[model samples]
Target: MTTRGPLLAFLLSLVVGLCLTVPAGAVQPDEVLDDPALEGRARALSAGLRCLVCQNQSIDDSDAPLAKDLRVLVRERLKAGDSDEEIIDFVVSRYGEFVLLKPRLLPQTWALWFATPLVLLVALGVILFSYRRRKALAKSPKPLTANEKRRLKRLVNED
Candidate 1:
């Protein structure tokens, strides 16, 4: 039927949109803590921690087994009465700082954070320098001497 074409297109688009979105419940029911307060802390921590396998997705949004493991580890730390800072420190010690989506501001990391701005400033300087040079070069030439004018006219005739 002619009507089926638009309906099929609408259904396909709806399915595609849903597929592209991150699943809200990547953490299994088993991983949820018994205490709501601890569970909320675990969820918040999971959201900040990057999924090593997925790279871009947070552990809370990633379905990777390693992400699941990390989530469990965070909950376990919470159960043990570790402060949020201590839990993060423990993970960072084991996995290195790459596990964090946002790199810490350390002397070594200063370059990583500043590289983009430095590059942009250098590029702007180069652009401004070249623009000034071109503008400077565009100034009118000194008036040709009578002899030079004669030579130019002669050269034009030869051409």
Candidate 2:
């Protein structure tokens, strides 16, 4: 109805959109360490661990109860003087390696990591072979027999 009304509506929508995009850390205040270094390490590890309930989201980004439990477990392990690797290994053992956002390179995961590239290469080879074969066929002209030429002449005359 008025410029002021439309402008106010636009401003309200902009504020709501900005609020939604603001990154909210899922870690609770009580779980934070006094030592900044340890807290930093805990945060890094949390970022790599996948939330089981929210498969694609990291434990650091997820709001699930299981994610909170994992965050607490990681902090506890850090306080107990566990190395980052040990804490990760403990979680992996408990939940299986699927909990890791980036899986470790090992015999078990070789196919998982390499299968897509292998399949892509195979598909590329097939496409190239098909293209080359089609090109070759096109380049090599087929000799028209006498009957075909006669048929062509008759068809042209009929038209």
Candidate 3:
């Protein structure tokens, strides 16, 4: 009886953990294609495309009407025998590059891609400069004033 209680608790926690860890996709049953290969391709493509209505979520993971539309469109394109690249191009042409979860590296996007690292480097340089300045100041003690030196000399004489 004692062992059963611990076992039940462990099983309950395991089930809850599994439920939390599983991905919650928004793809409906009707949205799935009969052909597993085509469906797999559609899912892969959908995962790369962003849901414009839910900016942070992929179309595959979003429940927005627009995301559903995009998923359906992707499946339709696959059924029409469009290659993955062609479908991606068609969507990109219609919606612009912002629909892509990862934007293509181009001349214009170079700055966009590098901006974070550039900012980080600049911040690191500033931090290092400040640290070095503080260290240098600490290492070299401030010179004693003339009055303080005289006081020290008189104290030594009394000693």
Against the reference, the lDDT scores of all candidates come to: 0.93, 0.94, 0.95
| Candidate 3 segments whose C-alpha is farther than 4 A from its true place | 1-21, 141-159
Model 2, 109-149: lDDT tens digits are 99989999999999999999999999998896888999999
Candidate 1 — which pairs collide? Answer: none
Worst 10 residues of 3 by lDDT: 103-112
The TM-score ranking, best first, is 1, 2, 3
- Candidate with the larger TM-score of 2 and 3: 2
Q: Write the per-residue lDDT of candidate 1 for residues 19-75, one digit (tens) a residue.
A: 887466699999999999999999999988999999998899999999999999999
lDDT per residue as tens, model 3, 85-115: 9999999999999999999998868887999
* Comparing 2 and 3 on lDDT, the stronger one: 3
Score every model by TM-score: 0.80, 0.77, 0.73
- The best candidate by lDDT is 3
